[model samples]
Structure formats: structure tokens, C-alpha cells
Target chain A: MKQIEDANQEALRRMLAADPVLVDVLPAAQVIPELTDRMILHAGPPIDWERMCGPMQGAVMGIAVFEGWAPDLETAANMAAEGAFEFHPNHHFDAVGPMTGMTTLSQPVMIVENRTFGNRAYCTINEGLGKVMRFGGNDDEVLKRLAWLRDVLGPAMGKALGAGDGLPLKSLVARGLSMGDEMHQRNVACSGLTLRGLSPAMAETANDTHDLAEALAFVAGNDQFFLNIAMAMGKAIMDPVRGIEGSSLVTAMSRNGTDFGIRVSGTGDTWFTAPVEMPEGLYFPGFTEKDANPDMGDSTIVETIGLGGFAMGAAPAVAGFVGAGAASGAANFTRTMGEITVGENPEWTIPALDYLGVPTGIDIRLVVETGLAPSINTGIAHKEPGVGQVGAGVVRAPMGCFRQALETFAESVGVS
Target chain B: MSETKVNQFLKTPVKVVNIGLEGFAKELEQQGVTVVQVDWAPPAGGDPKLADLLSKLGT
Candidate 1:
């Protein structure tokens, strides 16, 4: 028992020490080996087209139109029906997306590399809030923004990063936590820091002066622009610790609106799943819980690696943002999560905990024993397609997935 | 000061004895965390009927 526990700690230590950085922006086809023509990568566990929920179906059609595989949504829907494309989960290819978590072949994606481990992960560029394709926006306006990102912003970012790898993401995240950004639902500080890093680079990009300024302003205007980078950074760090035999740490936890799934370190890519639950928290003025879809997206990678919601105590404002009600409630949730994690992250301390390190390293065993679930702050998409974001809130990982993983662990160790 | 806790629990082996909810024990078991749950009930001496019988049979 002691040996197993030690092994788990060792793996977690490596994860904690990993340095993930945003190195470049590139077309998905150039960087992601698995993003082949007619194949779309999505979030959570794999699912077939027939079983897809409304928002996912909508996003697929939107991605198809953006890829020019189909001229319009109508054609895209028909193409999917005729099996003109292949569907797969992003986790299979070391990539993740938020909401419908859509990634198509031609889309531009952020490439984050783990400086310490040399592993990489990818995520689509943030569309900067409302009516974006990630939330199933298929209008001409959404497609136009994607084109601008691909042609102008992406090239400028790549130039800014240069051949010399980008800024160390962990350092930025550490500073962000201290400055009241949790790197999840609230990323005001991290975004500001990122823009500051890229401002000089934007000044040098070859794009027309007006276009370049607009591009810089686009990122500057969108607060969540840094979130996709942060999520990719998380993936780059955590993917390296995957499949460490007998190590019961949770390497990934994600939801597909239809289901919530998790991968355990000891289980080697095996996913334990349960039906996703609706998030509980504040909603947009015109929406309510009933209009909100089940929790979805790969953004939980932030919490999976001990940022975002795990550092909630550091960003009390995020509690009200995600429905935790108040700063004290967020603080309590953060402390509870600590009970189930392996240890505190020395680098990212929460002020509410007397500047205690934010809880890090989720151990499957600890979660099951403590009956505590990791709280994730996430955007809530509407159940219907094309409606875009309805709200943002906090949600607990389903206990059932943990239960199933525990059963598997018990059987594997011959303890049951 | 808080940085020192990066591996607080990992430095020690685990042995958790839960006194109430089995759910907590179940959760721990999944992660391979060591947990021992006590199936607790009220003491028998607290029951008036049982207490009276014990008193009547006392030496």
C-alpha cells in the first residue's frame, strides 16, 4: 500500500513541476497529426454522430461550413448524415476544446508545449465570447471572425512567439493567481499579462497597421482570450503523467454535455463516465438553469492541474460568477477540494487560505474516500444549437465516475 | 510558509478510519486511498429495556 501511494505521489510531483508554455499559433492541419480532412475532434469521451446532443450537432455543422466541406449549414448537416466526415474525441489526439469543444482540420489552434517534458497539446483559439462557433454559432459573422483569426491574428502570434519558445505559462498562471485571476472563469490578470507579452510583437507583425491594431484590440477586448491558452498549457503538463501504472491520480476530467468522463493515472486511458449534470449558478438575464445544457468542455483541464476552480479561494469574485454565491462559499469549496487532492501547489497560493498554496494533484483514492468532488467553473451553453452562451457556473464532477474508477482500481489490485 | 505543504499528505502513508458515511470510504477506495469505515450504532446500554435487564442480572 505504501509503495502504491509513493508511486502516485511521485507522478503527481512531476506534474506539479512541469512547465507548459504557449509556443506558437498554427493551422490544425500543420500541427495536429490527427486532424485529418473530414475529421473533427471534440471534448470528453468519444461518441458517434447519432448520439450527439443538440449543441454538438450544431457545432459540427458550423465547423463543416468553416472548413468549406459544405457550403452552408443545410449542406453540412446532410454531409454528416451521409458520413462524409469522421468524428472523434480531442483527448485521443492531445487536443481539447471548450463547450461543444469543436476542432476542425483547417481551424487555427494554439500549440502549447511542456518545456520540462517536451510533450504538446492543442486547443482552438478563443472566439472571444458571444455567438462564437464554439457555442454553436453558425452565422456569417462567426465565420468571418474565424477567417480573420486564421489569416491575420494567428500569423502575428506566431511571429511574436518567434523560434525561441514562448513565455513560460506556469509563471504567468502563478502571478495570475496572486493577482485575483483563477485562470478559469476569471482570467482578467492572465489575459492582461499575455497581451503585455504580445504587445511589442503585435507592433512588429507585417500585417497592415490598421489590421494589426484591430487584431491586438480583438484579443485585448476579449477577456477569455487567455483561457484557451491556459487550457492548452494544462493539457501539455498533465498529458505527460498519464498511464503511470498503479498511480491513482486523475489525469483528465471532462464533459461532453451528454456525459462526464475521467481518466485515471493507473488505468491507462480507460474512461470512467456518468451522465453530465446541469451546472448550478448564475445565468444570463434571459436564461435559467432549465435553459442551460449539462456541464461541458475541456476547460476543466485548468482544475485538473490545480488552477482555475481549485484556486477559487484566491478569486472570491469567481464564486459569485459560477454560482458559489459568495467569496466565503468559494473559499469553503476550495478548502474542501484540498481534502481530496495530493497536496498544495507551492507556486500558486490562495490568499483566503492565509496564502496557502492552491490545492493540487487530484488523487482518485482521496476523492472517493473524502466523498468530495472537484468543482469546475465553466461556461454554460444553451441546450439548443446557435443560441451561444447562456451563463457561467460551478459544477461538481459526478461521483459515479469516481465510483466506477474505484471499482476498476480495486479489481486491478486484487483487493476487492 | 504555505509552499512547504506541496507534498504534505504524500510524505506520510494513509490510514483513514471513517466514523460515519460509507460514501466517503467508497470514494477513497476508488482512488486506492486507504479508508476504514466504522459501522456505528447507538450503544446497547443506552436502551432502557436492555439496561434494566443488565442491572437485574448484575452480581
Candidate 2:
């Protein structure tokens, strides 16, 4: 009991020490990696896009056109089908994308720099669920939205962010907690705060009222506009504690459209992975389990840093989408998460826990011993291609991944 | 918040939190509500008597 208590205390200290700031964000094309034509970053299992379920293939084709790699969806489809384009999971790049969080060479990304640790991570903008190319749909609407994000939204946000002295996400998350936002499904508070921070820069850059109107409306309409900032902030916080000798803490937890992976401080950069599963929850009309994609994207960073589902009690509106007894579930999830974590986040505290800090970092060893893999509440991608979002739900990281990570950590620390 | 479901937990009242409120665990303590923060961990399992205890609390 003493050992457990000591470990828990130590965990809290590490979390409280985490002070992450987002300094810069950009695209993967700017940061080079050894990516080949045969690899595409799918979030779950490796699906052969050429022979993929329709939606995945469609997304592949759409991204090709969006990248100008292919002139049209048909050509993109043929190119992927003909084995010209390779597939890889986003994890390989130290990046996380949103649902169908697809990034071509052209997609603008928020380059999150952990100012404290001097490490960086990346994630693309939220594609706002459904029939979106990131889930493998290749329709004109998907292409147009992609075009707008690339040509307008990205640049606009970039300029606004630069002008606003850069958004301080940790503070925003702290405020969001008070206003009934877990900074995941209910981002209203954070979004409002983010816009307040960035709108001045946005106003300054626009040449006309129309541009200003567009920018303001964009921020107003999208509740999840703050996700990129939160992701960057999470990257900043987690990066500080990475490579902590003798520490069994989780540094990263993310999914490419293909697999769920985690990186631990003690384990270095290796990703322990498991097959991704669908979120179980309420679905939009005409969508069901068949249409849901396995969980994808880097949003898990929110949960990893101890917000999102762990803070769900603050955002009961999300209860409609996940399951019954959401408030109780949220508190329980946060409490259970505390068992596997190193500490509570001093800055990103949760009020429902009676001002208790949010569960900060995950430890692979505890996961194995407790058989309690981290629970993530996520948006479900369409299972078949082109369907978009089917539902929202919760899932557990596979025990196998944690077991593998523990084995690797044991070998590294000579604990075995 | 359903009364039927609330009544079903005839054990110690399961505290819940909504809108930045304290959780059921803390609330039960203040009201002298017969709630204990049981070991929710698996294996040996949660408090074995909570079921009977809750039934009594309900009465």
C-alpha cells in the first residue's frame, strides 16, 4: 500500500510539472521523413487501399487530387489501385491527424512545439465528421471542403494565431473546465476563448469585410476549432517528461487510421500497437456499426493529458452520444485512470474531482498489473468507405499493446 | 437523473457530478449518505456488501 501511494504521489508531481506551450505548427512536407509510395497512414489495421473498403479508397483518391498528385478522383483511385501510392500509419511520423485525419503533402498542419522540452509533434485540422475524405469518401463536397481548408482556413488560422501572440492553450483548457467543457466533445468554452485570443489577428489580416465575416463565422460555427490548439498543448506537456529515466509514463497515445499505438517515457520512441476498434454509441440516422470506422486521429492526446473522456463529467451533453450513466462513467473513468497514471495535472485540473488534478500520464506497467488499459472516448469513422461518421463511443486500448510495451520497458530498465 | 434508475441502486447512493459539481462520492459524505469510496479495482472486486448496504439505504 505504501509503495502504491508513493508511486501515485510521484505521478502527481510529474504531471504538475508539465507546462506545455505551442510555439509553432506546420506541415509534414516541411519536416522530412523516409516515407515511400507504398505506405499510407491508415488509423487502424493496414487496409489495402487499392482493394480497400470503398470509403477508404475514396478518401485515398480524394487526397490524391487534393495534393494535385492526381488530377481527379478517378485517376487517384486508379493510382492507389494500381499500387502507385503507398499507405502508412500516421504514428510513424510522430504526428496525429483527426478522423480520417488525412494529410497529403499540401494539407496545412499545426506544428506543435513543446517549448519546454524542445520536441515537436503535428496534427491536421478537424475535418468535421461525415462523408469526409479522411474517412475515404471522394465526392465533390469533400474536395471543396479540402480545398477551402488548404486555401483559406489554414492560412487564415495561421495568420490569426501569429498575430494573437500565439494562443496559450493550457490556460484555455483551464478555463474550459470551469465552463462545462472537457475540451473534447464540448469545446464551446474553449472555442470561445480561443477565438477571443485569435480574432484580433484574424481581423487585422483580412482585406475586406467579407474576409472578416468569413473568419468570424468559421470560428463561431466550429465548436472544435480549438482541438488543434489542445493537441499542440498536449504535445507540449507530454514532451517535457519524455525519456525520463526509470519512469514508466506514457508520452504519447494516438491512432493512425490503422492502429492504436502508445509511446512510453521509459520505452523511448517505439510504438506498441493493437487493432483499433469502433466507438460504441448513438449514431446518426442511416449510420450504424457497419459504417463506423475504427477509431483514428491524435485526439487521444486530450485523454492522455487527462482531459477528454476523463473530464467528461464537465460535459454531460456528450452523454447522448456515448452511453448511459455518462456522468457516473466520466467520474469513474477519471478515477480509474488515476490508478494507472503517474500524477494529476496541476494546470489542467478537473472541478468534478473536487479540484483534483486530471490524470496526467499513463504508465504501461500499471496497465499490465491492473488490466486497465486507458479508456478513450472517440469519434467513430465509417467502416465501409465514403460514409463519413457513423457514431461516437468509447474504447479501451488493447492489453496486448501495453503488455508488449511493459516487456520492452522491463528489458530496457533491467527490471526483469 | 432518472428516479427509476436511481432507486435501482438500492445500495449506497452512487454519487454523480454534472456541470462542475462535486461527485457522488463527496456528496454522500456531507449528507451522511451511506456511501463509501470502494475499491473499484478488479480481481478481488468492489465492496461485496455495497449491494446489501444500498438496499438498506434505499429503505
Candidate 3:
């Protein structure tokens, strides 16, 4: 027990010590060396093309076309079905994504380097809300936006970041939490903060004023713009927590619509999986649960390091949008989550909860013992590809994965 | 006959702290009794194998 506790403490210490900085933005192929021409990186655990959900399939087809591997969605679909492309989880390549989370070679990815751990993580920039590719929109409009991001915004932001050392994310997230962003469904504050931090450099580095304005407007307009950056920061922080011997702390939790998966620090990279759950919450006008898909994304990494759902208390404004009861009741979610975690993150405290640290280090042993699943705040996509976002809400990580991980962890510790 | 302790206690404004199932707590509340429902489930969802493993790990 002491060994496990010590290992978990070490994991927590490493996580708290990590300083993830937004270093640059570059093409996925150029940065992730393993990303070959025909390869595509998606969110959640590993799965092949045949099993990908409607939104994921849609995004893949769209990315295929965007990459010039195919001329149209129909052709892309045919090529995908014919094994003309390879599919891998973004996590496999030190990255994370939201919703369908399709990351391809041509898309520019934001790079976050963990200065303390000396490792890096990557994520594609968030496309503004509505019918976008991450939610499975693959029409000509979606393709055109992807092109602009690749050609214009990505390079501009890259040059801006190049002008400076890089943007430090820890304090920005601390500020966002105070300003009512749990860094999942609500990132308005952090998005604005990100623009404020980068605008000066963007102005200094710009070759075209029109492009700079468009890029600035894009970041300012999208409230969820910081979601991808938070995700990359979460990945960078947690990657260093992996492989701590005898620890029961979760290193990652993710869903791919078909399956929800988790990895424990003790078990290394082995994934424990179960059927993914559907989110329960408010829907946009005219849409209902029937239009919603099972939850999917690598964004749950935020919860792994104790932001997102675990910090819901900090963002009372998001309560109604996510159907999480009254704003005052939001703090109860954080309190309940604390029962299943190893400790609190003192650096990221909630003002509403008397500055209590967000619950950190989800311990599988405690999850199994207490029978409480980790909660996630998420956006709901239409089950059908190309329909895009239908709603937003909260979902629970499956308990089966925790139970499986605990069992394996016990066996590994000679408890059998 | 003298009232028993159970009878005396029952007469003093019934209150309940229910765990594991909400139905019991709901029934009490419906009967005009104060009830605090605690959200809970059987450890490891009552899977014997997992419960056993948890016990082995000193749960």
C-alpha cells in the first residue's frame, strides 16, 4: 500500500510540476515523424476504419479529401473502405483532439512542450462552432475552412509564436478557472486570454494585415478555441505521469464512440475498455437525444489531470448549458469527484469551493471501491456524419474499465 | 402496557439516512419523513470477482 501511495504521489508531483508551453504550430506530418502520408490520427483509443462511428468516419473522409488523397467525399469514403488510408489514435502520437478529433498530415497542429519533463504534445487548432469537421461536417464549406486554417491561420500563429519564446499555459488556465472556464464545454475566458497573449506577437510577425485580422477574429470569435490547447496541455502534463510503478492513478481516459478506454499508470500503456456512454444534457433547438451520438474524444484528458468536469464548480455559467442542474449545484459534482481521486491540485483551485483544489489523480482502486465513475463534460455530435454538433452535456466514464484496471493492478502487485 | 424504545423512537418525527437505493429514501419522503439519500452502489457493482480482487488489494 505504501509503495502504491508513494508511486501515486510521485505521479502527482510530476503532473503538478509540468509547465506546458505553446511552442509552435506546424503541419502534423512535419512534426509527428511517424505520421506517414497515408496515415490519419483520430481521437480516443485505437480502432480501425470499419468500426469508426458516423462522425469519425465523416471527418476521416473530409480529411482524406483535404489531404488530396481523394477528390471528393464519395471517393474518400471508397478509398477508406478499400484500405487506402491508415487510422490511429491521436494519443499514439503524443496528441489529443475533441469530438471526431480527426488529425491529418496537412492540418497544422499546435505544439506544447513540457519544459520540466522535456517532452512534447500536439493538437490541431479548434475550428469555430457550428458545422465543422471535428463534429463530423465534411461538406465543401468544411473543406474550405480547413484549407484556410492550413494555409493562413496556422502559419500566422506559428510565426507569432516564433517571434516569442512560447506562451505559458499553466497560469492562463489558472486565470481561466477563476473566470468561469472548466476548460471543456466552457473556454470563453481562456480563449480570450490566449488571444490577448498572442495578439502583440501576431501583429509584429504578420506579413498581411487582412490575414492577421481574420486570425485574431477567428480566435476571439470561438469560445472553445482554448479547448484544443487545454487538451494538448493535459496530454503534456499526464504523459510524464505514466509508468510509475505500483500506482493506481489513471494516465488517460478516452472514448471513440464504439468503446471507452482508460490506462493506469501501473499498467503502463495497456488500455482497459468498455462500451462508450451517451451524454445526457440540453440539446439545440429541434434536436433531441435521438440525434446524438455516443460520446467520443481525447479531451477527457483534461479530467485525468483534474480540470473539465472535475472543476465544474469553477464554471457555474456552464451548468445550464450542460444540463447539470442549477449553477449552485455544480460545486457538488466537484465534491463528489474528490471521493474517488488521490488528492487535490493546489495550483488549480476553485474560488467557489473556498479555493479547494480541483480533484486530481483519478485512482482506479478508489473508483472500484467507491463505485463512482469519473464525470466528463462534452459536446454531442449528430450520429450521422456531416450533421455536426447537436448538443452539449455531461457523461460518466464507464466503471468496467476501472474495475478491470484495478483487477490487473492487484494481480501485478502480487495480490492474487 | 409501557411503550417500547423502538415505538418511542418511531414517534419522534421519523428521519432516515438511506444508502445504496433511492427507492427506500423516496418512499420515506413520500410518507412525510425526512430522508437524506446517499448515492451509492455495491462495491465493484457486486461483481464477485472484482470485489474479491478489491478485498485482496486491502479495500
Instruction: Please tell me which predicted candidate would have the highest lDDT against the true structure.
Output: 3
lDDT of 2 by residue, A1-416 (tens): 23323543454465566555544444556653654333456443344664354555667777777677788777877788678887765655656666655655666777666554466666676665566776666778888887777777777777766664565566778889878787766688888887787777778877677767876787788887777667656766666656665556777787655567788776677788877666767777887786666677777877878888777766666666676354656677778888777666777677766887777667665676666778777777677666676677887777777767766765565544
In order, the B-chain TM-scores come to 0.51, 0.26, 0.73
For residues A1-416, write the lDDT of model 3, one tens digit per residue: 77788888898899889999999999988989889887988888999889999999999999898889999999999999999998988888898988888888889999999999899999999998889999999999999999999999999999999989999999999999999999999999999999999999999999899999999999999999999999999999999998888888999998888899999999999999999999999999999999999999999999998999999999998989999899999998899899999889888999988999999999898898888899999999999989899999999998888877887898788887
Error of 1 at A267 (Å): 0.5
Where does model 1 sit among the CAPRI classes? incorrect
Worst 10 residues of 1 chain A by lDDT: A407-416
lDDT tens digits, residue span A1-416, model 1? 66557768888788878988888888888887767888988888887778777788888898898888999998898889889989888888989888888888777889999988889999988898888877777788888988988888888888888745587788898788888888889988899899998878768655588888888899889888899998898889889888887777889998888889999888889999999888888888988988877888888888998887788888988887887886777777778788778788887787667888888789776666555688888988888877888889888999889878876865565454
Candidate number of the best DockQ:
3
Cα deviation of A414 in candidate 2 (Å)? 1.6
Candidate 2's TM-score reads: 0.80
**Minimal lDDT window, size 10, model 3 chain A:** A407-416
RMSD of each: 11.7, 9.3, 1.9
List pairs with backbone clashes in candidate 1: A364-B31, A365-B31, A368-B27, A368-B28, A369-B27, A369-B28, A406-B30
